[model samples]
Target: MTSAFSLKRTLNLARWNAVLLTRNRLAFVYAVVLPVLPILIMLAGERGDPAVGATSITTVFLVVGLFPVYYNVLSQFVSRRDELVLKRMRTGETRDAEMIVSIALPGIVSALVISAVVVPLSQLFEQPLPVNPVLYAAAAVLAVIMFTAFAYWTAAWTRSAEAAQLTSMPIILLASLGPLGASLADSNETLARIIDATPGAAMNELVRVGWFGFDGAEATEKTLSFAETWSAAGPPLIVMAAWTIAACSLASRSMRWEPRS
Candidate 1:
């Protein structure tokens, strides 16, 4: 095989993973049903309010990010590594980056596909199309990449596929902090900043701005044009980029090809 990364091989691996995911009932529930169920519930109660719809959109991506993008990848990588699957792949034509991306591709694609369906579904509840579609697209892509990297980094410390559940809680909660933590941290600006700095919150902020054109602090009546939306997105974009870089660095440094045990 040539030293060049093989898209064909990566795609073939991704297809296999897609099939495995569909065949495994529990994984199917985790990857597809669980991420989408709550969003549907939220949309049902939207009452034609755009804000509610926007929030539903944000929640959809956040839930998908945590479950399929982060947790599933972590568990899958750990299981594969413990099985010596990752080790075997390294001895073959699979490059490290290709192996990692292919393993993550299923969950990543699941996330994007679910988002595509749900975004349109939200419209049935009277949710308007995004005010800044660019931001939504950018946030989704960045979030998937960020969470995929974080999953690999988390797998480095995960002892087994089983242990991934326990190891994953901190990240799950952190990604989920959002405005709930904001309410809790209301008395403490420092805590609020920390919560907003999380990868999850950054992505949520992007979703909010993409849909509403203004964040919580800004006036609800305020509307920004496409260029202005980018200005408003600066902080969240910084937070996301920083987190992705940090996660990628740690994953590269500590990721394990063999079982911890």
Candidate 2:
């Protein structure tokens, strides 16, 4: 049972998150401007050659776009989680769940905005609409949840706000450079198998479905036929789910209400 007042406060906090994000010029650029730049570059470049197909371009953009939105936002949120602002909110009527929601609201909104921009822009180059919009949406939402939780967990271990950016580098780099996740989403059986094992690979697969319609059967066949190895993409989804749970559990157990002791 939730109260209207609590909901209102949560909404207000969400809005405040957006305002605070805008105030930080660096964060604003990281969240908004950075993701779109590559897309523009791709659009302006040559649109020929199967090597640079719609599927590949979209896959690249999706992966590139998520870095600034997910990594930066998560790092920022986690870095600030122990600030006086969060401490003050925790002492008030704001529930822990609401606090988390409020903290995440800005990133969520920014991701949505970035997606809106990317989808149409990709379409302008003749990329097909998602075959399964439902699954695509599910993957996108799950990605938001997974990365948000991961960021919080990372923040819990982080020593300071400055370290937030540094601490987040591994996940960011992995998401960017990991095998098959972004690079092999279109092809490369070996890479795809490797990507299926990584943390954020499921979302990469889902984005492929959105951009190029990757069905379960097709994915399974691709794995079996080309890769000659059964990928754990399905299992990776489970792993991602587990990551969500683990991140939440870790944050609950170790998250400091204020700066380190």
Candidate 3:
């Protein structure tokens, strides 16, 4: 007979996994330091400036999703499988879904924590409170789903934890496209369209609309009212949703639970 789903057991495993993640100094840097660096840079040079506000927060949001959520999750799955931990766990009461969720939980929480802190912290730089906090919340939720799925999907080809460094480069470069999407639009509209269709650019759009109140890609004299934000969010939302679905599907198809020869 199958065991019933248990939230308590899942959380316990997640807690232990979190401890492991935090203990690694390099992982610690990815989880904490890299995500916050953009904000610190903005503060040191342009304290309380609104112009860079959305850029800074969006950078933190995207950075957190990439390293902690994406890279760490990829590394953990590879390392655990190589050590036979995943295979061993399967011999017991743990369900496959439960195990996967638990493995992805810590990075999800770290991403959320960074997202939450940035809202209040943005005020320190004299930026206004987010005009559409709901959009911010929505983006954060989608980010966790998308990036974590990306990690699992990427883990399929990763031979070992060390191999993760090379495997994760495409994702890193994908994320790097976020900040450059708008700039690219000016010179090469077609290339810019492709970038905008990507998950990172979709996130950048959401941040620009939700946090800074820009209307779509173009800034106007007035900030968008409450209702306009949702309309602006629609395209990016679709892009992110499509990517999320693709990632989850690929992860399920390709993930390996046992060590390689």
Leading candidate by lDDT? 3
**TM-scores for all predictions:** 0.93, 0.77, 0.95
What tens digits encode model 3's per-residue C-alpha lDDT throughout 1-261? Answer: 567778988999999998998899998888767887877755865665555787787788788889879998899899999999999999988888888899889888888988889888878777777788899899899988999999999999999999999999998888779788877787888898899898898988888888778775546323788789889889999999999999999999987899777
lDDT minimum window of 10 residues, candidate 1: 214-223
Winner of 1 and 3 under TM-score: 3
Worst 10 residues of 2 by lDDT: 220-229
Q: Candidate 3 clashing pairs?
A: 48-125
Per-candidate clashes come to 0, 0, 1
Candidate 2 per-residue lDDT over residues 14-83, each given as its tens digit = 8987888889888887776765665654466555322233345444444533554456656566556646
Give the winner by TM-score. Answer: 3
Off by over 4 Å in 1: 217-222
What's the lDDT for all of these models? 0.82, 0.60, 0.85
Off by over 4 Å in 3: 45-48, 218-222
Cα lDDT for residue 52, candidate 3: 75
- TM-score, candidate 2, is 0.77
The window of 10 residues in a row where model 3 has the poorest summed lDDT is 214-223
Q: How well does candidate 1 score on lDDT at residue 223?
A: 72
